[model samples]
Target chain A: MQLDNTDRRLLEIIQRQIPLSSRPFADIGVELGIGEGEVLERLRRLQEAKIIRRIGGFFDSRKLGYTGTLCALQVPRDRIEEVAAVINAYSEVSHNYLRTHEYNMWFTILAPSQSEVERVMEEIKARTGIDSVLSLPAERLFKIRVKFNVSEVPDAE
Target chain B: MLSEFEKRVVREIQGDLPLESRPFAAMARRLGVTEGQLLDTVENFLERGLLRRFGAALRHQRVGYGGNALVAWVVPPDEIEPVGNAIAAYPDVTHCYQRATVPGWPYNLYSMVHRHSEAECRELVRRIGEALGIEQYILLFSTAELKRSSMQYFRD
Candidate 1:
């Protein structure tokens, strides 16, 4: 769907935060000079198009008493689909992607505790029979924030 | 301004700060508010859970931490919570989580490790394996970074 100006404005606003006020749509309307109902409708449409994946809280895991790490696993060429399915099933695995690499399947997961993280890895090895796996932990948190530049890039990629 | 309006302004600025020297000032101007007002809203947003943090995004390869990998582990269904908690406690483990395992690829828990050298990253993984008591895992390192952009939830 071609995003109109109002759609773009809504995207710009919602990317930051979904207004938490009772009348969030109304509040957004006030700022963007559009009607509250229009804002709500636009948001619904965006979601329907799958452009806006989810509207949820983004937390600082470090502050929330949870630690995070990025890990990659090298699966045999034929086992990509099987491995991807395994990684995608865990609730902790928020984001998983199939990438071109020696490991081939790259994914990121977030756990509430550290021990859980280790156990998950161990289980993967025993099940997959792929002993060559590397877990890269964050040495320093340089930057962590979502980016929204739909204005610059066309809506449909 | 009403507290809610102030919060809306804060949410907008916190998530979409342009990569500029005077980001606060730029945001204030865009929102048609004073810099002081923007600062106040930012403070409030920080108090709430809406804004996680404000920081820079770096290119790991450019900075020499080019060696990166996504690691996964399979913990028994009952022991997932305990194992995840133990591994996440380590400072080096930046991102960790649990996922469903596919047939032949049964590793479930996953983490991302970034290191200046490949060897260093491998060594850390070895240590994490021993530390977690999970001797088996698959280390999938990136040969190329195709796309690594933070999700733009608000964008259409």
Candidate 2:
């Protein structure tokens, strides 16, 4: 699944933004000098390849009356998987990773309210019995933009 | 506050938009709104900062960025503003934040760095440390990605 120059350019454009138009793909096609059908076909293939995990709106959950926090748990080496399963059971937990630290398990939870976030944390603690959980909410956000320079990198995988 | 229609639009498009010639058409139909109406709402969301972005979310690994790390720094409380802004300026640094620190955990500023390799990631971290003139930090490379998914809202 090698991405050619056009595919690369397409990825770059869409990762940054897509037109807010009734015929957005047609607009992208014009920009790419292709047709709407080609744009749709390429993007469909990209989605099938799992290169594009999602294509949609990313809302500021905070503005929508949601609260979230970064949480870490110190799970014993043998119990890491079990504890992670417990924490990941909640839909609020969007990301869970095993990192190289004493507090090895780190995850993020975004819920409808602050109390909902707290409730999820409490339940995780109760189920896993990992009382050494640390919830570190963001005091300030400096930046959050996840876009890669697909134009430069060749298909490595 | 979000209008009722806006909430419905958000609920419909928070997941992947169908890959079609007119991706918003089906969504508009389901929500009982015209394509123009739905797109207008999304455009408004972007203008109002309710939506951070509306586009493709790429898998970094698939796109050749195999190495990623979460670097935590222990910056002095007063310098958080300058230090955070500096880190945020880097294109490779995707997320930067000043977070609450717990006892025994003094690292307050966190940044997520992506590169082609672990060695490259380490070099970037070292350069950042030198440029920022900060000493205490830890590079927590992910040993495993237990779960990664987008948040679903208004599903009820």
Candidate 3:
């Protein structure tokens, strides 16, 4: 994953904010003094390497009338895979993880309403036979932006 | 607060955006609007704060980031803002939030930290704790990522 200076610059500028234009790559190319084709080729390579997940719109789920909760459960170590499968089956469970704690199985459920999110959580409890979960819905979003500054770090680690 | 047109735009563009010379132009063509009009809609959405960020979200794990943990800390009510800023200053700490506490649970501040390995992750957490000087915390490392998805506001 040794990214050159240009690759680093592309990562930095692309994530800061995408130019809202017809020829957005060309606009980015103008900044880097590279051709639009070069920009596209590098981006494609990044995607192939899974460095860039996707270049697209990021909307506010809450603002769009959706509610979510970060849920934690004390899952049996032996049953992690089986239980995770059942929980992850639900589309509402956007993020599910096996964490290191008494509450080992953690996940996030985002749905159109509170009732919907609760229903899905309850469903997982019944299926996994876990009685309770720390369903901590955000009282207030203190921070959410997660832009990693590629420019600050060097290529070869 | 989304208009029908805005909702339509979101539904159409929430996936992997096309990657061509004129990517936005391609999207604009698909949405049956001129490139300028589409850009205006996006700008308006941004100005109004409907869109949080419009850019490429890199997958850090694939980009050489190792283990990640969700560390929940019990912070005093008075020191939340300063402590939160301190925690968020670390580049490895991607998401930091003040969440609600349960009946017995005391953690109010939560942070998602990434590092090259578990040891590295713990070291960073320890440093953050020493810097802030207020820490009753637990690190919940993610052993597996079961589901990670972008919220589809319109269709969903």
Candidate 4:
């Protein structure tokens, strides 16, 4: 998708941070030297295009008394969809991906407690009959910020 | 350690914010609080490090970063910090962490790398490996995103 310089800058700035104000869009417009209406219009288009998945507060789950772990399973190629459905049934499971590896199904489960996460994992294993679920919890978090460098994207203009 | 009202605020803002003028006012109407109160709560969350950032969660693939791979590195205990930092320094690498490796699967450090193309992703991975002098790594390319959603803290 071609993005003009203004749209590119908007994407970059919004990813870094959005101000906590009643007129947050206006605040962003002020920074980008565009009107709030223009900012909203561009953002609406971006959201529709699925470029901007969401715009909201990113809370630290751990600080909020939640625990999470990354797990992977070596599901048979034939049953990938079935196994994924069982895994995704749990609200605790936030991210589930089919990756290219022996342990092809990789996912992350976040819950209010370690036991809750474990319970969900175990249930997923039992439901899918994939017992060899590797639960790799984070020993250390070096970084988690997911801001992409949109400024580097060539401007359509 | 949050009050009832604060918890409600957190639940309200955890998902997508409305795209409009005075969004907080719209949210405030739902929560029976003033827009000022909601903004203050969000600011406090930021100051307390409870909220990482209020921003757009982008789809990197749509924005020209099509190549995505999860590279897992088996770094030595003594050199984990330097190697992790080296991986984290790359802007394209969004997430970096040291995870507990299982018995058969022996990869301790993990980094999510994104680039414009598969070749570029491989090249960036090569550069990172060269800089860190760590070759024991495997890149796992995601074939499909089955599920992706933000954590909903207080379900109401």
Measured by DockQ, the strongest candidate is: 2
lDDT tens digits, residue span B112-138, model 3 = 998877899999999999989976999
Q: Give TM-score values for chain A, per-prediction.
A: 0.92, 0.95, 0.94, 0.95
Each prediction's DockQ? 0.06, 0.86, 0.67, 0.74
- lDDT at residue B134 of model 1 (Cα atoms): 85
**Model 4, span A1-157: residue lDDT tens:** 5788889889888998888876889999999999999999999998988889899999888888889999999999899889888888888988999988998999999998899898998888778888878999998988887888887777322
Report the error of model 2 at residue A116, Å.
Answer: 1.2
TM-score of chain B of 1: 0.78
Instruction: Give the candidate order by descending TM-score.
Output: 2, 4, 3, 1
Clashing pairs in 4: none
Better of 1 and 2 by DockQ: 2
lDDT of 1 by residue, B1-156 (tens): 235565456346425343233446666787788777766665565686545743323234432455576666766768777777777766556667676555456776776777665787889889988887887786767674433434322221
Chain B TM-score per candidate, please.
0.78, 0.97, 0.93, 0.96
Ranking by lDDT: 2, 4, 3, 1
Q: Give per-residue CA lDDT, model 4, range B31-77, as digits (tens).
A: 99899888888989999999999999988777777679999998999
TM-score of every model?
0.54, 0.97, 0.93, 0.96
Q: What CA RMSD would you report for each candidate?
A: 14.1, 1.1, 2.0, 1.6
